[model samples]
Target: MLQINDLTFDAWGRRFFDHASVSVPPGAKVGLVGRNGVGKSTLFKLILGELPAGDGEIGYPKQARLASVDQEHPATPVPLLDTVLAADVERDRLLAALETAEPEQMGEIYARLSEIGADRAPSRAAEILSGLGFRQDDLARPMAEFSGGWRMRVALAAALFAEPDILLLDEPTNYLDLEGALWLESRLKKYPHTAVVISHDREILNNSCDHILHLIDGKLTLYPGGYDAFERQREEKAKVQEATRAKVEAQRAHLQSFVDRFRAKASKATQAQSRLKMLARLPPVSAVAIEHTTPFVLPSPDRPLAPPLVRLEGVTTGYDGVPILKGMNLRLDLDDRIGLLGVNGAGKSTFAKLVAGALPAMTGHLARSARLKVGWFHQHQIEALDPDDTPLDIIRREMPEASEAARRSRLAQYGLGAAKVETRVENLSGGERARLLLNLVAAEAPHLLILDEPTNHLDIDSRRALLDALNDYQGAVILITHDRSLMELVADRLWLAADGTIKPFEGDMDDYARFVVERAKQAGKAPTQIRAAEPDPPPKPAPARAKVPTGPARRRAEAAEAALARASQALADIDRALTDPGVFAENPAKAADLGRRREAAQAALEAAELEWLEAVEAYEAMKG
Candidate 1:
């Protein structure tokens, strides 16, 4: 349990918290939500003792193991799985002591290891990694081998493996794909220990949190139940406060008017003085802190958008001829709203960059309209800005031909206040920086907009604003986001960026959401269990024949084939049980159990086939 008593924290000459008190009971899954720059992250740091309290008392169990996602890893040639498993410091300490322990202490160390389940650390680490969308081969892969996004996953896996008494998760969904995020939400729901998560994802907040802690205007409010309940309760509280404020204001006004009218008259001088005293003694009505509600306004393209703004025919794109997306056939017609979906490292970002023309296509033909204008909001695009430059400077530099009014007008729509327009970009909060970057793209007035993880740093309200703007805009949009609500609301069509290709998803958002969850579950299952789900075939080639695996790669192909054969045999045995009426009659319960197990087994087989197909495709492509 954690108790925060009469907390008062001040920074930048402004009070962030004033005599705020809150308690987190044991095993409470609390979602700490607030607008960006509200000091939610700062509170986490204070709880972790990374920062000294400004003026408050914070108490928690002394033995509590505090854990949060590590943003950085030391430069070491350690396997990803090994690095994660090593987070269990106690396990490592016990193992180290076992090597040189005294005779009497040897039994004690062994008993401690058994108590902590240290021997199963590797398996436990693997399960966490699998849930986070790591493949079997990734377990042995060095941390240096993965991309930045994958390394972030490694960091997340390490945090989970630590298995702390209190887990502090800040924007945990940012590094995850839809599948990984869904898996993490499920994992947190089952987590026995306490967790306080800071996320802009409403789905995660509503599903995983048992309580909601809102930090509003120098005060803290803890409400029981999930985010939805918190919203309802907060609204009710606001309404009650509004009525009380109105009554107080009316009484204060009457008293002041009486004093003003009679204070100068000698006949009622004493009474007027009394009225003045009463007016002074009346407490001011507490005003609700007005939220900064800034709607994102995107300017329409200057000219009419031609149909099919961009087309890629049999496109193979990659860096240095190493293909990430191959034989991609895609077209973006006017007003096409396509939501890009896939696991991390599945080339969603790569495809976006290719379409944005940031990368040159390695093969196949590409066509663009003569008047094509492209607007892009790539992940972390805010970092691309000059840190020393302000929003005003950035807008002016990007649109030099525009008048001053135009530049300021564009910035204002993004909620960049007059004072903040000239503040150093480096000094801006993550959400503020996000808005500036968005403004940069919006000002371009492009017919096609490609946004990759645009809602990463945005709060729920900002996301809603962006979605509303996008929905009303008459332009083609290729949006890549893990925010399901944003995707479901803005995208009319869905595109799956996986299996070395980009293709239309023939399902609704709900179906895609279910697929993401199912895929995550399959990630945790045995290989023999997921073979029934079909892996999308790579785009068709002109010759209509795929290259076959050969040479050293053939060994891997053969091994996969053998393993799949074994999985198939396991399925056959289950089928035999399904057909055995004599066994059912003898033990009906046993038959029902067998039937259920067979279904899971079939799902596992489907997943295995998908993996096998991807392997074969990659190997064949390498040979070619």
Candidate 2:
């Protein structure tokens, strides 16, 4: 368990937290939520003891362990498995101990050896490495060969292998594909230790966390539920506050009206003075500013396109001599909401660029439907914006035909007000630039939209807005985003660009994730299967003394015994069902029903078996 008391953090004269207090109990799974640049990461660092707190106490158990995967992964040139294995110092020591133990000493160290063999051996290392998407052959490769994204995975694997008591993850899912993200989600759910994660992916947080903590305006507020529940409650509270403010303001105005009218009359002067004093004592009502809502309207094409909005045939793309996409063939259909998935630097972006006509495809035929308008938003779109130009100016330049009034209206939709729109692009924050870029893309209304990492710098709300807009659009879209929640929400199909080929997946993102994990598990197992240590023995007969005296007595006893046996069999079935992930995946409704049935069956089986054993014992005592 960990606790923070009276924590305060300040940066450049701006206070992020003032006397904030928070506690994370053992085995607690909590999410740290806030707007962009609100010091979520800073608070995490403060807890981590990496930075000195301005004022407060951070307390944890003496033996408590902590580990984290930083937002910016450090550069490393090591094989992925080796990097992960480096975290488990104890595992290495145990392995060494087991290897060097003498034959005479082995018996005395068997208990220690068993502990290591069960949980800390090379098998565990291998299992975790494979679970994280690393192949057996890749384990021995040097870490220097992997890209930034793969390097980040190495760091993640290290943190996981550390098996600390508390995990502080900052955007762990940022670079993960749907498969990797889902595997992480599964692991976190069953993880024995507590975790406090700061993430922009809504689905990951919602699926993995049991509680939500919001840090806003130097205060900490805990919500006793997941992201969806927290959002609903926050919205309701805001509405109530607005209503209360309105009512208070109306009463204050009524009191002021009485004073204004009666001040002229001498006899009413005293009463008016009393009312004025009362009005002055009333608390001032701060006006609740309405958030500017941007209405994103994608322009409808005059004509709809047929199949194959974009196509790539025999494409070979890569830097230098390395080919990422080799003789690749891909076709994007009209009105298809396609999700491009693969590991980092796996030609996803290259394919996107090839389709957008931003890069040349070597020895390939690139084609697009005639009259199809394409609007492309790359991952580095912020760099594309002019630092000197204000958002208003950019919008005007992009939409020259639109009236000045309409241009401002479009900007307001993305939370850019009239005053802020005039601010220079350089002065705007990363999240602001992200919103502006999305707004610019929405203004074009192209029939085919190709976006690469569109949600990179967006906050939770802005990501939702962009996702909603894309969902409503009736055009062909090829989107590449690391936000798994956004992909699941908007994508109708998936295209996995891996190992020089693009494979089309004809289901939801969940199905694709399941497929990948199952495949990885199968790939990790050896071809040979070890036989069981021993086979089950045949059933035994009942004792002769326990035989019933007559027909009715025998029938009742047989019925009871048969019912007990059936219950025992049912318990065994339930145990087997729990091991099969497919049982939960293929039949959710059946799975839910089986859970309760399993508990009931188990209890009944236990009671019946106990009674049967007791009966056998009593019979043996009487015979003796």
Candidate 3:
């Protein structure tokens, strides 16, 4: 569906893409992955024609729609649902035409609208928004009511709702919670048309995409299958390349030896000349380049803390007198690795603050071991860094008692090299800044760490490095991140922030994912009711009359409708089981099994719904 041929682009005294060529097959979901500052976004800009390539071309079918969420949706008075529905230009055009089109044009217009499923646009838009973390009531609220992060999700929702021929998403999970990310992953897997996503989240790349597009050294290589498959294939290819290079080097040496020995003898002069030509004709092989990422340095506490380093009893805390999290009773041991799960605004951050000692309980007892020390790293810290401040300046302040040499050495240990130490924070890459803060926060060897959305800036390799550091560190952890792979690998226990309280989540990530998907479906189930809040559009004149549906078409429609109803009921039952806290708390294994069943039921319902839509359309066509 898309092709890039010998594409060369240059900017800022560097070549971004040099003779890079690749073809993306139709209907393929491809993950575009590379290291930071490696021009992934630049390539997107080139594809979108936002940046001019120095040579070659990016080609796709003419008139094919391409959509991307380049930035947050503008803050406007338009309701979120209408803002998303307006993304479908063709549907909007047809709807507008209904008011002024000649009576004779009405039939064709109505047919086209039916063909494009225009009647379902509002609900479809609502479904996308819900998957991206919008509440049921949020759909009817004005866009201006949302924060920038929420607006960013709205932009993503609009792109997905538009269902362009080619969809481009850049780090879509960055703005999302784990719930939203899981939903998006499921949604992208079923996207009908082609999609190219730029993501560092390994789980999304492995689960959502069919192909991995690697951009490295100004070249593009498309590997069939997911991120894990790409790594294996690349490793094999590198091994083969190294073996071939060795073989070629041996042949070259032999040819050169023959030429050197015989070039001095007249009898073998002619043969030597032939060997010389052969030696010169031999192809030179370049050694395979290995990619390396600086490992994160997270110091473990020098001494182990006693069990139950932190204990809370009926803890209630929030801004001012208003409580955001209530009746929070939890214990954190020195060795506990707690995965914090919740949608945004579900009191995850507030709980983190309580644990970090940044916020005190308003009405309940909270206890921590006398010698307990805590290190907290959060997403806001990166944003809160002074742009004009240099790493050197920050390090100097952080280590006022240490020698200058020792401070510089510490920054270097944090992956900030000599060249970057004096550079302003604004000039540093997001990964660099993240690495600096992550290391600095843990440098004192605290007994407990509270990390909130810690992997937002790190690439896949860096995230892996962070995971390695976390695994090796001997400290309690309360981790909150959208990166599922890291969370699954690092956390041995789970805590959920929900219903205005913090409680133990007995099930694993799989169960939680199912619960999230089902909850999103429930949130968007009444899209028509939500859309009713909008001002009604002008009345449309009816199209030409048609014959009634035949028996076969009617029968098919009725059967499909019945199947859809059955599937929906089955899924609803599963959703109830997944949502009940008691199911998980009582029998964890049974809860996990129910999660798998829920997934199957969800797929069945979607299939039945699609079949019903097709059957209804057929019935409508027969009537016309």
Residue 600 local lDDT, model 3? 94
RMSD of 2: 21.0
Kindly state the number of residue pairs that clash in model 1. 15
Candidate 1 per-residue lDDT over residues 532-600, each given as its tens digit: 344333233333333231323433555566667877888999998789788788998899899898998
lDDT of 3 by residue, 494-589 (tens): 788877888877666877787777766665657867633422211222234221224456557877998999999999988887888998889999
Q: Where does candidate 3 have its weakest 10-residue lDDT segment?
A: 534-543
**Which regions of candidate 3 are displaced past 4 Å?**
531-624
- lDDT at 42, model 1: 89
Question: Once model 1 is optimally superposed onto the true structure by TM-score, how far is the C-alpha of residue 46 displaced, in angstroms?
Answer: 1.2
- For residue 512, model 2's alpha carbon misses the true position, in angstroms, by 1.2
Candidate 2 lDDT tens digits, 1-624: 888888888887799889998877789888898888889989888888898888888899988888888843455666555566667776656556778888887675666657655344444555555566666666666777767677777778777777789999987776676557777777777777988989877876788888888888787877877899998988887888788889988988898899899999999999999998898888775654454334445554567787778777887876666677888777776657788887555688888777777777677787787777888887577887778999889888888999998888878877788788899999898888877776677565688888888877777876777776776676778888767788866666677776676776444565556655565455445312222121111112234423221222222344457779999898889878877899799998878888998989988998887766665555455435
lDDT values, one for every candidate: 0.80, 0.73, 0.88
What C-alpha lDDT, on a 0 to 100 scale, does residue 211 get in candidate 3?
Answer: 100
Q: Give the TM-score of candidate 1.
A: 0.78
Candidate number with greatest lDDT: 3
Q: Give stretches of model 1 more than 4 Å off.
A: 100-115, 144-149, 257-281, 302-306, 513-624
